[model samples]
Target chain A: MMAVAADVPGAFERLVEAYEPRVKAAVARSINDRSSVEDLSQEIFLRLYRARQRYRPTARFETFLYRVIFNACVNFTQYMARRRALSLDRALDDDERGNALEPADPGMARPLENIEEQERAVMVRAAIDTLPEAQRRALLLSRYEGLGYEAIGQIMGLSLQAVKSLLWRARDNVRKALIPKLGEGPDA
Target chain B: MPDHERIGDGPVLSEAQEQQLLAYLDDRLSPDERSGVDAWLARDADLRRLLDEHRRTWELLGELPVPDEASPGAGFRENTVQRAHREERLRQRGARRRAMGVLAAAALVMALVLVLRDRPEPWARLTPEERHIVQNLELLENFDLLQQFETELDLAADVEALQAFEGELTETLR
Candidate 1:
């Protein structure tokens, strides 16, 4: 990131290579619009470029990058919602569908067991989607990004306590949803 | 023994304590803090149960869908870098144009001032009739002064003085 700031050749490209997957995954998790992921992720990188000069190393670069990704996904989601509201006649096309909810592998060599596992995974995705927006974002950042509450707070612009409360509620929500699906184990 | 030890440590977990336990399970706590949470969990059945629930919940969340590792198609990086470079060029161009505009405006004001200073008086641009109009402006301004004198002779003397004042005024203005 510092190298990119110094305008080193190929430095920005190195950043793109290193962080693109994480950025894409974050975008994919945040919004339901699957087709717009690529464009939204690209916009995040462009935003990073525009803000390169202003980049301060106050927190982890991943934290800063996720903040950028989070803001962009939120804006994109709101935009899509407005589009939907205004153009109710044009229902969502297949491309704009929740492709993220689809299992990664449709054809499993293990047949029945894999299908059952995949079904649980799909239910988990749906449960995550049903989480309140703030809780969902916090949960995704915590679990997927492995970010600490302080960093998540910084990214979400909430107090550390607020983030902790949010994550607790989010975890409880997911647990409730998963219990019936995953079965009554010792954890339940 | 377990109940007595747990009562001393704080039996009912607050929302924050519960969150801390979850964070501890996620390995978010430091070594010393983890040891403290470990002691608590060892002593309390309810706390241990809560920790187990949180751990399983986290595990299930880990199953959240991840997109396939397909490439973001060709030229994505190239296209983004090119657009950024183009935007930078446009921004710099806009700044330069703005600076040039300020310089042009300053130069124009300077040129006007120099032309007016080095060139003849503005009276030079006036036609004879216009000059006559200019010369009578003081008279128009002091027409009331002419009405104050009762005699025609006094009025003529005052008119002569006023004409001399107008000449001085035009010279000073020029």
Candidate 2:
């Protein structure tokens, strides 16, 4: 990032190469559609390049990158919301199209061997989808990305305490939704 | 771990204590806080159940399928950089074009002003006939006097009318 700031030749490309996989994964996790994933990933890089001059080192580059990711995801969600609202009139005409969020790649087999586990994963995803946007983001960043509360707080524009509470509430909500389906008990 | 301080034997898990438990699960609490939570858990099975539930919930979240690492098409970065440079170039070109247009407009206005400043007066530009009409504007303005002259010309109706016209023309010239 600092290299890009210094106008080093190929520095921006190097930066993109280093972070593209992580950013793409994050976007894929957040956004469902393949095209949106591609477009948003490109948009994120473009934003980074544009903001390179103003980039400060107050936070780690990953933190800054997460901030960009968070903003893009949030904006994309809002766009989706508006689209859903507009499509409400056509809801009756539209058939139940299954979530095309993740396309099946024959090359990649299911990570979980059991079909039941796959269903549970789906339930968890649905529960996560129901979470309020902020909580969902906080939870995903912590659980999946292994981001600490401090880093998440920086990305989320929240205090460390707030991040902790947000994650807890998010987990609690998901658990409440999941327990009826996945069941309770530590062993389960 | 935060110190387990109870003021007047309140409920075992108050809101603050709940936060502490959650934070503990998050591994955010200090040693004393951890001890405080452990003490509470040792005294109460319910709190332990709640902790377990939260922990399970956290674990289940980990069950979320890791999105496969998507490698963007080759030259993705190069293409992005090229697009950025292209956009910047176009923006600069647009700004330059606008600036040139503004300068051209200003120069045209300046040239016009200079030409007009160096040129002779409107009267000098006018033809001899147009100059004569401009000099006679006051006479044209006096409707009553011109009407009387026209009526006299009509009544005289001869060489005498011609003489009257000559007299009026000499007076108008003067």
Candidate 3:
């Protein structure tokens, strides 16, 4: 019930009212793990609150918010990729292990896992994860947020044309990845 | 009917074509362009395949549920409002602090001037010897003072010596 406090020119209420979903959407779009999304979303707002007093309208409020959220997501991704530390206290169903899905080559002569579907799911996610941040964001904003190209451009501070190009590149990569995995590759 | 009708730029889409396709998808293009792309899509199965891929991707992405934020009953709007109030307070306080600082600085300057005005003048602080020398020296130098206080006490050497001291004092002040 405690009112949030910030030290900026604009009201935190204005930012919160206008941008809560945008921030949450950004977090969800950036990360694949549902478990970490809410925490990351809270962390994004916490950073926003901390910056409120000094927050200048250097760009559109949405653009600024996206920048902050994007930075936090990048940091989280780096931490996950490196330390790979699992949050023991989180309540997500631990139905599947995070790394039980690393792809193995038959050339290595190892036995294939029983659940190839789960393995493919993991592989597909890994391919998406390897995409450049800009491409990923463009794809997510266009596809997931259901934003028009102009809106996506505003959020990402790109031109509409550039947003489309980026989205296309992302789609091309996704297609290339899916085709190989779906048994339509050259080797197959 | 377009100049790009010949197909061997490796079938690459230009920046213009890509922009057109995007506009077509978002329903921002002209009818002519839409029909053109629609015809092109029908003619080029590869391009159609790519379109289907983008379309299906979004469909799959749509099925992925958005994560629910965990907080007490105070939802996002309330939390944001609270944050805004806190921010507004901080900004107001900062502005007030700046205003107070400017007032303090102005008051300091004014206080200093008042104190200086009430105190003895810089010239008044001089020794009588210096004062007398100044009075005679000014009289001889043809200073514009029409009011004269007569004094018989001085050698010409004292005037010369005071002139040297005056020169040094003027340099120091400068």
Best by TM-score: 1
Candidate 1 matches the true fold with a TM-score of 0.74
Candidate 2 per-residue lDDT over residues A106-173, each given as its tens digit: 32233577887777777787788789888989988888778998999999899977887787778778
Candidates in order have lDDT scores of 0.79, 0.78, 0.64
lDDT of 3 by residue, B1-174 (tens): 332334531245777776676677667778898898899887776566656665555444454434343232247566645654576589789999999999999999999999988998878799999888887996657654343322323455689899999999999999
What does candidate 1's lDDT look like per residue over B74-158, in tens digits?
A: 7777877787788879989999999999999999999999987898878888999999988998987888777675477787999
RMSD of 3: 14.0
Instruction: Name the best candidate (by DockQ).
Output: 2
TM-score to native of every candidate shown: 0.74, 0.71, 0.57
- What DockQ, between 0 and 1, does each candidate earn? 0.34, 0.42, 0.16
Classified by CAPRI criteria, candidate 2 counts as acceptable
Q: Show pairs that collide, candidate 1.
A: none
